[model samples]
Target: MLASLYKNNHGTIAEYKRIFSSSPAEVWNVLTNNENLKLWMDHLEITDLRKGGNIQFHFHDDLGTVEEITITDFEEGRVLEFEWGKDFVRFEIRPEEEGTQLLLKQVLTEITDHTPKDLAGWHVCLFHFADVVNNEKNHYPENEWEKWYEKYREIMK
Candidate 1:
């Protein structure tokens, strides 16, 4: 089962929990490698896969400019954390019966009208993560993210 919760305030926090059908090491590889990331996430350039290594992702397109993120922390087969603008995000992995348990959290430091859009974006992206682990191609819904953000902004008010 997968679940998520979000609270909008000085910062917005979103958390997602799910059980995956893969080992923590396998899942960790998908999460840490830039090549695998390109399959599921925005194009990425990771300097190193060590704790405190620099990480950056680019979503450059006609819609907008670059979306660069920095890696804050990393624990092999366990956890990874990063920052995007004023937002902080983390991914935590644990052992589970069938495979691995994954938890993803994103904290944004500022309550904007964009809260709903942000949450929805995470929702879609997280599901994409699940898809990749399940052996499906990870295709991000960039257009959907924009559309949902508009709808979410309206709902946030």
Candidate 2:
């Protein structure tokens, strides 16, 4: 599904919600654990699990460098929020009858040209997250981003 976008006096906000057929702990594991993380977003790795901790966006192959974004808020099993460029990306988890519900809110400071790409990236990553949690044996959908990118471009327009 396309993330719902809203405009504010300051900028834009993109919100996405997904329900996973797993416990809250399971969903939290996929979000914070680098083992499942690298499969979906190759560049992201959690360096710590505290408010003052950092999430590294690794440029491992080329520069061997990483961009460290500080964690703004955290509650071990419920909420995780961090800086994303000039904005904030927050993930909230809640228990559901079936499993867990994940709510992602991207607090955008501005609607830049790169917004759609980031939105689409998150969209595709969530799909992979679901598959990972469900233990799908099929290969990762490497080509899925292009389709989502197009949708986000239109949505962001």
Candidate 3:
């Protein structure tokens, strides 16, 4: 069964799912490898992929950083779970008819409020993931990004 977003002692949780044309191994590599992650995700440092390992993400746009995410779980080519700040981020991969289905769950612990900016950033990031996996020459446009950011600010407030 799919994990549901729930409010717990920590915070709120958000879930997202997407199907990619790449194999599960490829997706797993992209998620785990720092160089491949940078192609889509922000700059990141992964100390290791084992349980109890630590990972860090640095936002390219603002110099903001996500430090010390402990690897709570890891299943080769299948699942990965880590503690990101007060939240937990989990990625699950399943083989599909075309390629693979990736389920991303972000458990927002300690964050009491929901903001559109947060959602918008996630939406854009997923779009970028799709674009990169599809080997598109140009990912998302600047105007589109600006629009999403604007919507984020407007809706968050």
Local accuracy of candidate 2 as per-residue lDDT tens digits, 51-137: 999999897876698899899999999999999989999999999999999999999998888888899889887877788888775
1-157: candidate 3 lDDT, tens digit per residue: 1223556665666677888889988888877777767777675678788888778766655657566678999888898898765667788999999999988878765544444445556667777777667777564675565666566455334
Off by over 4 Å in 3: 1-11, 59-66, 110-114, 141-157
Question: Model 1: what TM-score?
Answer: 0.77
Per-residue lDDT of model 1, residues 104-127, tens digit only = 887868767666766777767767
| Positional deviation of residue 100's Cα in model 2 after best superposition, in angstroms | 0.4
**Rank by TM-score (best first):** 2, 1, 3
Clashing pairs in 2: none
Error of 3 at 120 (Å): 2.2
Instruction: Provide the lowest-lDDT 10-residue window in model 1.
Output: 1-10
The local lDDT score (0 to 100) that residue 5 gets in candidate 2 is 87
